[model samples]
Target: MNRRPLPQIVLGVVIVVVGVVGLLRAMGLVDLSLDDLFSTWWPLAIILVGLAALVAAPRAWIGPTLIVTVGLLFQLDNLDLLDVAVGELLWPLVIIFVGLSLLTNLGTRGTDDRTINSAVIWWGSARRTTSQQFEGGSLSAIMGGIEVDLRQAGLADGAEISVFTFWGGVEIKVPPTWRVQVSGLPVLGGWENKTVPPADPEAPVLTVHVTAIMGGVEIKAGD
Candidate 1:
């Protein structure tokens, strides 16, 4: 699997463009001043991050899109271009969005749940499934935490899993020999894969699809 960070690339372009625009203004080649441009356009950086997240993983785009909408509204309000108070709308919209998100697909989700071993948690904090031979399963941590240790586990060539964390976090421990692929959209959150690639260079691939909102997911080398 291609491990290139697409979001980083997009963000780099945005930063470069903004810096170049500011330089042009300073050189008297543009109409707007540095302050005016920064104040009026800097919020776009946040919106673009959300957009990149949505593009990276469409399956869980709502969280990122909500973040984008809120940011845009706030920026407009700050620029005196909006009449209504966007702040008042934030909490209500967040509640509604969370409700809809849960109702839509809050299952023991995976590429194929019925065919794999798994563990899922909704609230509080706990974990399970210390399988010695894990073969691709879903792990969810919502408004809580979870830890999965699969150091001794085994996987087939194309095994995959989906992890969703909302206002929560998850930690995964995997064997060093596994070839892992991590993909996700993070809204006020992060997804990090710290597992080292095996020296053999022909390890089995384990694809992890994730959705993170106000939370985080991490993968670490184990055993």
Candidate 2:
């Protein structure tokens, strides 16, 4: 039998043991609180499972570790170790780390395959408008050769927009009546803006801000 199958067997046994333990506790054979199950014991189980998965199938560790970490973070919030708001803020970091790890693994595996590497581009855009407010959002490719294009996405009269990219190129075309702020360091390419002016007092203007790392960015005036 392959060494990979051993991890699955071990995982199954561990889960069965947990189920049996829970049943025994519910029947008064063992005394355990929900707090104990969630805080101290659960994290240990997570670490153990993470190790097991890493040994059995390295590629599968990302999902299990992510689930375990998020579950533990929520448990910490419940136990008052972390503020709810702080926990919420940190949740994205956890996801980002997992995504980065997954990407790193994929990159390593695809190093010899240029086609796979070049297919990593992604693009997205959104717009919102109302009587008192206008909003627009977009995210494009990240570091590497990714490309994102957002054209005329934002509130009509007055708009607030934010764009984010990691290690990639992004281009946005906005109405000529919008104000723009570009911030952050691009590892490779510099930022460029065309026809962007200071805040306009008389004209209803849209505000656009972009954040990126190690990438090229271009923003242009449009209809």
Candidate 3:
């Protein structure tokens, strides 16, 4: 029972459903077409993705929450339930959400251990990790950037760093002796790992799990 497998499962189901509907339509068994269905209900997909992200990474809820909000607004507009245009209300709602997120620390939680939990919204941030027992931590950036210097940190075992970025970037600097493994989804965005692995196969590993939407992440070895 992995905590993050639901997203993948949901994606698989969506693909299967689309294929089945397409096949049924081609056979004249269904009146609805995929294009029409998607055009009318795409916002629901965004909301579902956001919900999955929340389940996948509860601590990094800032991006997911915003996504859910946007999806709801779009859906409401599609249904003609609002008095004003969604475009007119979107930015104001975003600003309000950002304010609330700042006050609530964007759902980031502090731990008693040396685990970094940071959130940057509409601003840039720079931090350095010097923890001797660096466990993993979560980092969230929305409409901002975060530069984390972890060269001074000593990883006793392995570490897992979760990063969520929306229209922002995150740069991580690691020690050359460490090995880096990065995995995650990026929508209209990407990540780059420029760490040259040391010859020792037993080098400590640092795993980065990221969710980036219209954002980027870069990791490299630094002094």
Q: For model 1, which pairs clash? A: none
Expressed as tens digits, the lDDT of each residue in 47-152 for candidate 2 is 5544443443232233334435665765565567875654566658555754654464353322122111111233332221222333333333434333322333
Cα error, candidate 1, residue 176 (Å): 4.6
Runs with alpha carbons beyond 4 Å of true place in candidate 1 = 1-4, 75-83, 108-169, 175-177, 183-192, 199-202, 209-216
- Scored by Cα lDDT, where does model 2 land? 0.47
The C-alpha lDDT values of all candidates are 0.67, 0.47, 0.78
**Model 3: lDDT to the true structure:** 0.78
Model 1, 83-117: lDDT tens digits are 88987888787677657655544555432233232
List, in order, the clash count of every candidate structure. Answer: 0, 6, 0
Candidate 2 accuracy as TM-score? 0.35
TM-score-superior candidate, 2 or 3: 3
Pairwise lDDT winner, candidates 2 and 3: 3
Clashing pairs in 2: 142-167, 142-168, 143-166, 143-167, 143-168, 187-214
Give a tens-digit lDDT track for model 3, residues 39-101: 888899888777766665566777788889899999988888878888898788778766765
Ranking by lDDT: 3, 1, 2
Runs of candidate 2 exceeding 4 Å displacement: 1-133, 143-158, 196-200
